[model samples]
Target: MNVFRLFEERVAGALGRLADAGDIPAGLAIGRVVVEPPRDPSHGDLATNAAMVLAKDAKTNPRALADKIAADLRGDERVAKVDVAGPGFINLTLAPGVFLDVLRAAVAAGADFGRGGVDGPKVNVEYVSANPTGPMHVGHGRGAVFGDALANLLVFAGRDVTREYYINDAGAQVDVLARSAFLRYREALGEDVEIPEGLYPGDYLKPVGQALLATHGPGLLEQKEEAWLPVVRDFAIDAMMDMIRADLAALDIRHDVFFSERALSRGETDHIAATIADLRARDLVYDGRLPPPKGQAVEDWEDREQTLFRATNFGDDVDRPLLKSDGSYTYFAADIAYHRSKFERGCPEMIDVWGADHGGYVKRMQAAVRAVTEGRGELDVKLCQLVRLLRAGEPVKMSKRAGDFVTLREVVDEVGRDAVRFMMLYRKNDATLDFDLAKVVEQSKDNPVFYVQYAHARCASIFRQASEAFPGEPFGPQALLAADLARLSDEAEVEILRKIAAFPRLVEGSAHAHEPHRLAFYLYDLASSFHHLWNKGKDQPHLRFVNQTERESTLARLALVHAVRCVIAAGLSVLGVTAPDEMR
Candidate 1:
């Protein structure tokens, strides 16, 4: 029932027939050929670039090739008219019946109308891997929503996707967390302790200290610093992970795999060392020294030989260091090991959702993927920019519990998860967003989540009225499939029908481009179209969706409304937003 896909197959068929007739060439590539909506609706219903894309390959003039393609399309029973527009674009206007048939299929599918049928290798999407040291802040929520929505979109579009989270439990931050919790543990044992500079001062550690005291009963207080630090750090990491998981649950995000960085080097597997040895065996590693820093006195720069990866050979701007001057593996070495783990798990395509500060790190990591996977794996990183929280245009204060930044759970609890998720995705990921707390809950067009959800609720209201107008008529999606919808010839109704037919194409495009914002934009536009049609029905009595005197016309309009409802629900499901049945 995908109209665009149908046209693509039809266009390819026309090209094959031309080859069979010896029109130009037989092996003209059609990969570049595409079928999409016409830029100008007045031009036609569907547009294709097959002629322009294939002309040079076939050694034919562009306009002449377009004419031949248009002639072949004119022979299609569904095509009402075919025209060759400027240079080589072929626009085909399908008969009205074709659109109506597509509408029937859409209604019959209900909430599953936009599910696609693509096939590919498994994809691993790692996101929200905030260091397991504290509660999630608002910035982490943005990456969490983006990754979850993208994974949902890929699943809807028929891709095998795996949601993963990388736990950074091996860094200096965890050591600091252990010391910070030690202070709180003393306070829990009735000793006054003041948090010193360079130590965490958040009240969140109080619960961790209480939990530690409950488990060990002050035995750890007598142990030396080195003896208790590891035990306390492990305990604190688990507690923080519990809090982070709870925060993500509020937004309906769950990761399938929680890979730990400590596990990379703690057990029998020192993956970072193993990866470096493999690269060295392949001659991709070397003992090298980078040039002195720019605009610096050469004497001030230390001369040291470091273990380096030949990253520039794979596409990076410069060769990167794998070991620090202290002879320890760098963070980049651990990351390369992590991505290699993904490839070994049978995922060649991987995506990382990182904060905006990591924008400069993307290229080097991608280069390492090439060197480690030996061109067998690829990595794509999406950077989410900072979110500025506002309440009625004024900055909100930090959370007392977190001590510095506001917790993600606080925002979701204030305005509901639906508002937080929808507004986070309402803008592109790389753009800095100004989130207004007071504006998202307003019941108006300015609140896109409310506007879209209200559109679904309005559809429910229309069905209730239709039931009263026609007491014995069945108005479910399946029953509406039998409706004689030809009576929906009005311009406004047809506009809605067109919008519903475009859902599958929109879903496919958004998933392929790894952009979920496109789905949000499409949903808002569809909601506006439905709302406009309903307002028009108020002024034109005959256009009313429920009229006892015109049973046939009423059923036709109701069928259209049902399709609109189904599409909006499908779209909201992808974005993790609720399409409510009632607004008030």
Candidate 2:
């Protein structure tokens, strides 16, 4: 149950009563009224800006309105006290029974305690569209983890989410990969080969080459470039995709769909051509000459009429070229067609997770989405910043296996998948993250993954101790749910309940914002509060969860512990991290 939402409804009812009583003008807008946790916990359990938001519209003083609202709220059975703070804000302190009810709800809901209430639209999340040139790197891993976690969050929040990856197989990079694999194939045939410049030099292509040699042997060695390029390109891309899939599997990331760029042109539909034709019929595409791009001088810059999309009309800085000087479709053109395909698949809500370098491309892509979907589709692009992998404050330069850069697998192997996933999501997607290998694994409060996992583990340990202390008494969730929770009257114990009760609200907010980091932060805060309570019990034996003398209080406290464990497990599941019963 969402206490904040319940209170918000009550507050709205009070405002309606005021309107009927003629204490305030009729039909004052109350849509913006919000009830949430107070900025300072010491002030009250919840705070609302209803008075401040409606004061001017109702032609009433904010403080006077707040006083009236507070007076009305005090009549609520669930509201223990209500006070006006800072001229207009109304702060509410909930009754003790309310907090007890939250704990019981959490236990009853179990793993689904924090699941969101709103049923949102179907969504398509596209991320980790790394070029099929090699295995994924650290930056790609960040996007993968972030996107996967976001998909999980949306599903938990009651949205139909499709996790997708757009393969860049129809680009120049894949051609280079084909050539590189050919070199490896030649090497497999016992011929020494040197990889030329502008081609991939990583050893990962060696396997693709060996596979081609095993299948075709020396037959392909004599073919012309045109004859072999297509066959070799398809084989090389498939092998590289296998490698990429394995890398993602190492981090527990799986995509529901792997869309191919080549399919846009090769499929029976010819989506790219059809998209251009559709836009041209709508007068959105035309042959036009674009001025030279600003701040860059090109000796070969030519202003010639070419097929262009009316990106400028849709809010882009310039009308973007659809066909290149070579007559092939530009990357932007393919992207527009790809997004149109998503819309055609009935996903009006699309989210693309791109790297920070693509910041300038957001507006144009969004504009294209709007045009193609007839203003019915919405696209939100989340740009993930670079990850600086460090060790004890020193920059980590190279991977153990990947020659030039740190590969995702190597990082996962070195520090583990849990550390990588949690650290990747512990910050805002747009903010650069510093992932220190030495720091994240530390068994201290500074390490959020460890702290949160330990909280779950601590709950398990408490339950085991409770089983021994209460020998023969059932300590499962159902038994705890039947406990007399009124025994949980301590301020610290009630505070923990308050935090646990906020999980549903937190899930709703994070899912609506498309921000998984908020959930990560919330888990950390919950773990911190739980750990503080555990430490408190060290000094005050009465606060200990397993009390030898008081059976009723011990059962109530154990119920609280179970609630904490449930919420942490649910949050960690959204992040694709394990909530260990015991940490090794």
Candidate 3:
């Protein structure tokens, strides 16, 4: 049960009654009202800005309105007290029994505990669109986990989600990949091949070389570059993409769509021309020359009135170039077509996950969507800051030149998927994360994944103890719901109940902000509450699960334990982490 939402409704309803009774002015909008926990918990259980928001509109003093709202809320059976704070904020203290009731709802809902419905709109989360050049690295791993968790959170909050990966197969990078693999194919045939500097130098392509030998040993050697580039390019890209797919599978991330950039232009689809034409018709495209970039500049930069998108009109730094001087479409051009394809395919609400190196590119891409959709569609870009790898508290250096850049697979193999996923999302996506190989494997509170998982395991231990305390007592929903929860009046028990009651509000806020790290924070808080209760049980025998003398009390405590497990498990599932029943 969402106690915050319930309290918000009561306060809002009371305000409307006051307006109708002429105690407050009529026709004031209350849509922007919010209720949240106070920063200082000692102030109250919850706080609302209803009075402050409505005061100016109602032409009434905020403090006076707050006093009237407080008086109205005091009449609520669920609210034990309502006090007006400074600047017209209302602090609500809920009845103790209401918290126990929240525990009952959490137990009844189980794994489905905090699931909410979409009151806004559907969203498309496109992530991990790494180039089809090589295996995904530790950098891509962060975006993949963050995007997946965010998508899961959106889905849990009731948004229809589409997890997508845009495959950049039709680029210069893919051509380089093809030539690199072809060189390996020659090496497989025992040819004296000197590796070139511009091509891929990683040893990861050895398997691709071996596979090419198995497919066509001697025939491709005599073929001209023109005749062989296409065949080898297609084969090598397929191999690289397969490797990326396997890497994602290791982290339990499966996208709903694998959109290909090549498919937009290479096929008879002609989507590029179609998309450009659509914008051109709207007078958003034109032939314009761009000023030379500041500082570092391209050597071959030529001044020409090239085809450009009117991005400046939509708040970009400059009108973006759509075509290179060589008459080939630029990367930005292809991206426009890609986003247009998303809009045409009914994904007007979209989010793209990218590395923080691409921060400067966000505004231009967002401007593209606005120019194309006429502000009809929304595009959110979540940029994940770099992940600095650590081992034993020291920096772990990566060498692209040494051909030993650590792959995503190696990180997963070292720490396992759950640790990798949790640590990746443990921080805000915009904040750089230091992922330590040593600390993540530790089974302690310092390690968030283990701490959260231990909470689940501790709850499981309580259930085991309950099974023994009441040998024949069933752990079914009906039996637990009927138990005398009034006996769970301890401060620690009530604190945990309060945490459980905050789940729905947490989900709503996370969904609204499109921030999945909020889930990580919530899980940390919930786990802390569970751990506190567990330690309290050690000091107070009555707080322990095995209430031997009282069968009803034993069942009631088990219900709370089981409820905490339910909330944590559901949250971990959203984060794509395993909630172990027991931690070894």
| lDDT of each candidate versus the true structure | 0.92, 0.92, 0.88
- For model 3, residues 199-278, the per-residue Cα lDDT tens digits are 99888887898898898777887899888888899899889889999999999999999998889897677888887888
lDDT of 3 at 61: 88
Score every model by TM-score: 0.98, 0.98, 0.97
TM-score of 1: 0.98
Candidate 2, run of 10 with poorest lDDT:
397-406
| Predicted candidate 1 versus true structure: per-residue lDDT over 1-584, tens digit per residue | 78998999999999999999999799887999999999999988899999888888889888999999899999999999999988999998888898899899988888889796667789999999999888999999999999999999999999999999999998899999999999999999999999999889999999999999999899998999999999999999999999999999999999999999988876888989999999999999999798876799999987788898999998888888888888887899999999999999999999999999999999999999988889989898999999999999999999999999999999999999999999999999999999999999999999999999999999989998998988888888777877899998988888888888788889888888889999999999999989998999889999988989998888888899888888999899999999888888
Order the candidates by lDDT, highest first — what do you get? 2, 1, 3
Off by over 4 Å in 3: 295-301, 397-404
TM-score of model 2 (CA atoms): 0.98
Positional deviation of residue 564's Cα in model 1 after best superposition, in angstroms: 1.1
Model 1 clash tally, residue pairs: 0
RMSD of 2: 1.3
> How close is each model in CA RMSD to the real structure?
1.4, 1.3, 1.7
- Supply candidate 2's per-residue lDDT for 69: 91
Model 1 CA lDDT for position 356: 100
After best superposition, candidate 2 residue 271: deviation in angstroms? 0.5
- Residues 1-584 of candidate 2 have per-residue lDDT tens digits of 88888898999899999989999998887889999999998989999999999999988899999999998998888889898998899999999989889899999999988786868678999999999988899999999999999999999988899999999999988888888889999999898889788888888877788899988889997899999999999999999899999999999999999999999999578899999999999999999788888876876688799999999888899999899888999999999999999999989999999999999999999999999998999999999999998999999988545557989998898889999999999999999999998998899899999999999999999999988887898888888999999988777888789989899999899988999999999999999888898999999999999998999889899999999999999999999999999988
